[model samples]
Structure formats: C-alpha cells, structure tokens
Target: MSETETIYDQIEIEDFTFDPDTQLFTYPCPCGDRFQISIYDLQDGENIAVCPSCSLMCEIIFDEIDLQEYLDQIS
Candidate 1:
C-alpha cells in the first residue's frame, strides 16, 4: 500500500513573496474562506496568520512555498 502524503508534503506554493534581500517569506492570505492568514518569518515563528472563522492557518515551511500562494493558484 502506498502511504498517504501529509499536508506539508503535498501543499506547495508558487510565486511566493520571498524577499531575497530580507530573506523572508510573505503570505498575504492562505485561507479558502473569507478568513485569511498572513505568515512571515515562518522558521522564526515570529509571524503566523490563523483564521478562527475557518480554522485555517498559514503554517508555511521556511524552505517551502508559502501556503497562500498554493491556495491562490488552486482557487
């Protein structure tokens, strides 16, 4: 049987607002619903955006694409 891929493994964002100068990732909004999330400095945990209305979270991996970009591309 094949193993199910995890959310972290499956979801990948493109054209993420990454500042080559600042070396930071930016997510304007990553929620399907009206509730949105904007996360930055994901590795540092200094910036995290969560939507209580839709139970959505911008839990972006530092080296990976921002969740927002993924969501936007799909939707």
Candidate 2:
C-alpha cells in the first residue's frame, strides 16, 4: 500500500508526549500500547510512529521550525 494509505491516523506533534531522556515522542495507541518515534528520526524527516504491540502506525504532523525550537529548549 502507498504511504498515505497505510497511515492509521495523522496526529499533531503537540499531542504527543516527549521523553527527553530517550528523545522519543509517543501517543496512545488503540492496542493498549504507545506509538513511538525518535526525535532523531523526525529530524531526519521520518514521520511515522509505530506501536510495538500491534500493526498500527500514525503519521506525525509537525513543522520543521517548531521541531527545531523544541530541540533548542530541551538542549
């Protein structure tokens, strides 16, 4: 399937919880787990967040500038 077709949903970056220690952004998944993606992966232009307990993935919506600003604050 195409990338757009495979995404379970599109979630805004602000809705996710960021763990500074692991540098991971996460959101609740329907499968009783969290969908996770690394900040480094996002910086590299990867936006898909996957749940470890199931076959669900979501596309993260974010602006590059906002991401950079967040990183700057955390740094």
Candidate 3:
C-alpha cells in the first residue's frame, strides 16, 4: 500500500482579496468556489486558504507586519 500526501500550492498573499468589512481574504479556487481565510486566522499565525467546496487548500505568503497594519486600520 502507498500513502499520498496532499500538497497545497503556495500563493502570494496579493493574489487574494482582502475584504475590509468581513476581514476575510479570498481567492478563486479551481473548483468554482472561493478559497478563504480570515484576518484573525492570519493574526493567529495561520496562512492556509481552504476552498469550501473542495478538499483543496493553499498557503498564503505574507508579511505578518503588513497584515497587522491592515488589521489595525480596520479596527
């Protein structure tokens, strides 16, 4: 038997849309749904964007400091 690991593609944070009102970052997934991650999740050191319609996820690369700035402005 062989085991396969799910590998998620790494994406630039700029590729995702940051909603100021909802504070959620979203990107279009190949599954026709959006990959989403919240600013609170990012603040907690999470960078994974998961598609609600599928078992696909990606890492969002971003600077923690820059994220904080956005959070601050919204707050």
Better of 1 and 3 by TM-score: 3
Give per-model CA RMSD. Answer: 10.6, 2.1, 3.3
Clashes of 2: 0
lDDT of 1 at 62: 38
Between candidates 1 and 2, the one scoring higher on lDDT is: 2
Q: Relative to the unseen true structure, what is the Cα RMSD of model 3?
A: 3.3
Q: Which stretches of candidate 1 lie over 4 Å from their true place?
A: 1-15, 30-57, 61-75
Give TM per candidate. 0.28, 0.87, 0.84
In model 2, the Cα lDDT at residue 6 comes to 74
lDDT values, one for every candidate: 0.39, 0.89, 0.84
Displacement of the residue 69 alpha carbon in candidate 1, Å? 17
Instruction: Compose the digit string of candidate 2's lDDT tens values, residues 1-75.
Output: 365547789999999999887889999999899999988899999999999999899999998876885686579
Query: What's the best-to-worst order under lDDT?
Result: 2, 3, 1
